[model samples]
Target: MDSLRAAIVDGRNTAADDDQFIERLAQLQHEHGPMVCRSIFQTLAGIDLPRDTAEDYWRQVLYRRQQLSRILGRNVDLMTAMCDFLRSETRYLPHPRLVEVDSFERIVYESMYDGLTGLFNRLYFDEAFAHQISLAKRYNTDLSVLFLDVDDFKTINDTHGHIVGDVALKKIGAIIKKTKRDSDLAARYGGEEFVLLMPHTESINAFILADRIRQEVEKEEFTAHDLTYRLTVSGGLASCPLNATEPADLLHMADSATYMAKGSGKNTICLFKKDKRRYLRVKLMQPVLIKEMGFNDSQAYEGKSKNIGIGGILFENDTPLPVGAHVQVSITGRNNAPLLLIGTIVRIESFGPNSYDIGMAFSFKEMEKIATAEIAQFLKEGA
Candidate 1:
């Protein structure tokens, strides 16, 4: 009730649209109109407003004004009548100090919350992130940030339409809201991207939560326009005073971890691990197409990427390509764009009865570009 009153006062001071406030007012009148009318009528008409009749009268004025007019066989502005009654009886006036505070609060609310999801916006995130960092630094507390991206979100938008895309985003928001604690801060970082700031939390705890969110989203089906679609998200989590000491570095680390998660698979969560390897290998669960360079081998072999790094990749092959044999590796990017790399078969190990683990070392300069700074950072941290 206090919050409701504050919101109403804020709305009035900020010159916000009055429909929401008016509706709230109507509901309040409907619920407790008898005692309210009795107090007001005594002040104005010097008489009691009958309980039984006043309840119905206020209900009609609040919720059934149009129907009441028809029933009474007369058109009347019930809102004005109610307000006039208040004006004559109650000294209904907005306090100047309260209005000033209300206006400030409205401004803050608009700036902090996302217009669509009702989650905190990015602007507020920057402040919160810095504040959390300060608290962690001062008190030696743990802090973690999870950076998540919806898998194949572009495909959802392309196939189901933008409206359905919006539905998916909103559902994800609701899931996060339901899954997270009040202490955690959730923000829509951008389109198809979200950031969860968990203060005084460990990286493993962050990963567990991220995985839970991923699994729940995967299990839930989004229905729109009679089309049902299941979606998944990949997340990367980085901890403060562990992986990073600064805000930008922390965000970068989390984002990098998220990128690795996406590259490895679309529905998994990964923790920031700064591997010492020259090339950071990410587990790729999807199939990769491999072909011998210059069409030397006309047949293209199908293989699943076990892991991918800047300089090399480990993959499964039934008939292992000979060491030193050069081949072209093609995989799908996040946008469904094709990525091609040239590498030499570096190592092969027997895995199963018919399958072999093939390690290929990339030789292309473009391969270097593909291994991002986040991956390098992870490697360096381990180093």
Candidate 2:
């Protein structure tokens, strides 16, 4: 309940958006609303808020659901979180001190894009490009653009349909996102085409990245509608400082390169520069789950952590495990005992599938002395 209240305090989740919360929650469990509610109530009790206050909060949410049901003339599932929160004692609490309203609005707006594919609707790309160009000119950094077209898109679209095309786009977008560092942005230009804006990345990097994206596309296979299709992408690579002095000119140069790549051949990656880095990076996130005992009544039995990093932990799912149950995980990867952390699932996220993703503050003072750092380094370096 404290985290729930804190999230409300943060202004991202609200009792007002009860319906949306229910929808997102349902993604995790279809028929476990009651079980979910009980777990949530139990978890709420462990928080800083008084038990009576928390129960009152829950009661108010139920009352609100009843009132809403009367107004809307329908039965509201009182067990689900949003409905419960509507009746929660904290529902009427003072608003949070968040100052950045526009940031939330921007995040809501960005969620519309295919994050895996990096495609903006035709509408968003224009504005974003303009914004980047403006920033580049203000900062006096070199700005370059690369427009890419996947070769044989129609043939793939015809043979495997739009699903395969989408898969290809997503895979290619991920490749570019991994290829470029934090300074660069790539957007789905449209269809099987993508546009990249490189801030301060020289023409050499732009051309190399374009070629890499193309080669990356060329190497992947798309499976859709039960058929696998070998897919390749063609790119037109252009840049600033060499081909053009302005953003507009750079965009034009890159677009013409796309035209040239298609003209030259369908399955090749063309570059605006002859020299560039040729290494390809493939990224994959690891999932971690928890161990269940022979006898226990814990709400969640397992968790998952995504992308464990150098200095900290990466938790994706959560669960509650009592001592003696033992935390058991099953990951199919290159063989190794990944990381040896000393802490257990202390706190967890209760949102989805009744699974907890706990945050672990490492207790090992010297992980290398304990071989924890060795395992972490091995997985990171072995990769």
Candidate 3:
């Protein structure tokens, strides 16, 4: 109640918009109950009234104020009525000292947001991340974190000067904001890095969003000093309950995965590998056909499966595929029938002069049960 009074007094003194003042009153009433409106009405009316009567009068006042606002095409002042009532009752007038509501709001906004990129700063992200972790723990929901770093950021600064580098960072920040979901929280995690907190999301979904942001950044062009250049970012995703429930551990996993993405040649997204032993991996050197998801059969290339697992497969290919690229894999099943599976390339490493080892995680949500069952059988036979 005292806080409500202080807010009202502050609003009144600042010559705040009447509509904003009314909104504050409405918010206070929502938080503290009808007692807020009742107190305001009783005090202004200068009469001791029952709770119901005071609340009823307050409601009527609100309705009339709305009608007058519509008729006047502007906010109708409730202060006028309060002053009139006090004068008619020969009561003492309420006086509020001068306070700057605009300045206070600005201060609060600046504290939480970065002035350069307009994204949440590190301090705000830390506080919000802790709160989200608590909520996810309480609800047993999934939470994913995406860590991204600009590829060759120092090179951009050194080659084009700090002003151009700042422009590139700002452009990347805008791209992230445009690509991410409204519920996701994006923050500048200091110096060429950003973090995204996605509540109630799994690693795969987080990967999709992160990759989209990466692609957007790659495609965007930044111009400063009459020179235009493009930027790319590498991202890593880790989820709670799937990776680690501990916040620090999950964040570290994401950061480490980002480093892996950078090591794998940047501009890609990597999912944190929780454990290699989670699924039974069978050593099976078999010929498999591979192609990007939307490509034609003629465009499909042949790769040999070095190992197979219920969750994923490790294959050796002549050409290296980008991490996070969706691909279709066709492997010969035990029945001699070809088993086609859709999966995402998660890891890639050069094996030889013309060969690369590619790790693919299966998209179980899109795969049929029979396909997974067949893979299980193959793993069992090869185990």
Candidate 4:
């Protein structure tokens, strides 16, 4: 305590020093796990430590690392940090372990497809790009990529905030999601920009979809902070087999077309003119929902949420919910009073056992601000 306070008072080390510490801590990971971390902290504190207290402290750190692992969706960095800590003491580091190709393949497949939009991701650009190359090598089918970006998205986030930004994204996502048919692939490449893969598509067809998406985004009004704003997107379309056989050539072509659109101005679509290079983006926002909850560990709590736009929620094995059953919902602090709301399962998706997601429309009134705010706060508090 005295050393920590002195360190803080003297500005010796801030709490965020975990970065450099993490590197040193990585070396001790193998021998003591999180205990090595706790021991190091105790050594720094220079206090006589109780065995039980040290154990508890280490346990808490372990829990926090595990929780972070879940959020980051990867254990590599933290695991590597611990292993490095071990190496410092022994002058030896753990050898690299080989990963199975099958595992890599599976993750790559998942990476290619966007879970939210059901389209492919930026990674799939390579997939489709390569596929096009193969086809061009053999048959002569043309493939095209339309790199579309939402314009002035920062303004949306600046004006309405991220919550509203989320709404815009979902709205735009819905629009793009519906715009593409069975043959087209769409993905939220990063923030505001989306990539579309059109197989066996002509530049004309890709432009048609691009124009439709732009117009739809422009016409649609996203409401945030009790204000409505029009949205629009800029597009750059580049075709393969016609423009270039190489993937880089296709990217360069599309990048050029996207640039021309941006250079000319806002809310317009432009296909790559063989050598142009530019990119302007479409503007959009979307909502973020808190997927997990932390209760006081009382009795089982109910989880209820209604889709603002979609039909009823799914009730199937995919969501881990049983068939024909209604769920209990607790919107954290707001549901301090039991909700008058009820939802019955009407439909289910095909995913089974892992858990079934339910398709349910609220039998009661729309949830009030308190519920939503509480949920938003819960997520913000890092709970």
For all the candidates, what are their Cα RMSDs to the real structure?
20.0, 21.2, 10.7, 23.3
Q: What ranges in model 2 sit over 4 Å off?
A: 1-107, 110-112, 115-119, 271-383
Output the better candidate (3/4) by TM-score. 3
Alpha-carbon local distance difference test for all models? 0.71, 0.54, 0.77, 0.56
Please give the lDDT score at residue 316 for candidate 3.
95
Q: Is candidate 2 or candidate 3 better by lDDT?
A: 3
lDDT of 3 at 103: 68
Candidate 2 lDDT, tens digit per residue, 178-225? 877676667787777888777776544455556566666677776666
Any idea what lDDT model 2 has? 0.54
Tell me the tens digit of each residue's lDDT in model 3 across 63-82: 76676678888877785545
TM-score of 2: 0.42
List TM-scores for all candidates, in order: 0.48, 0.42, 0.59, 0.42
Query: Best to worst by TM-score, what's the order?
Result: 3, 1, 4, 2
Our model 2 lands, by Cα RMSD against the true structure, at 21.2
Residue-level error in angstroms, candidate 3, position 378: 30
Per model, how many backbone clashes are there? 4, 17, 0, 60
Q: Quick one: how many clashes does candidate 2 have?
A: 17
Q: Score candidate 3 by TM-score against the native.
A: 0.59
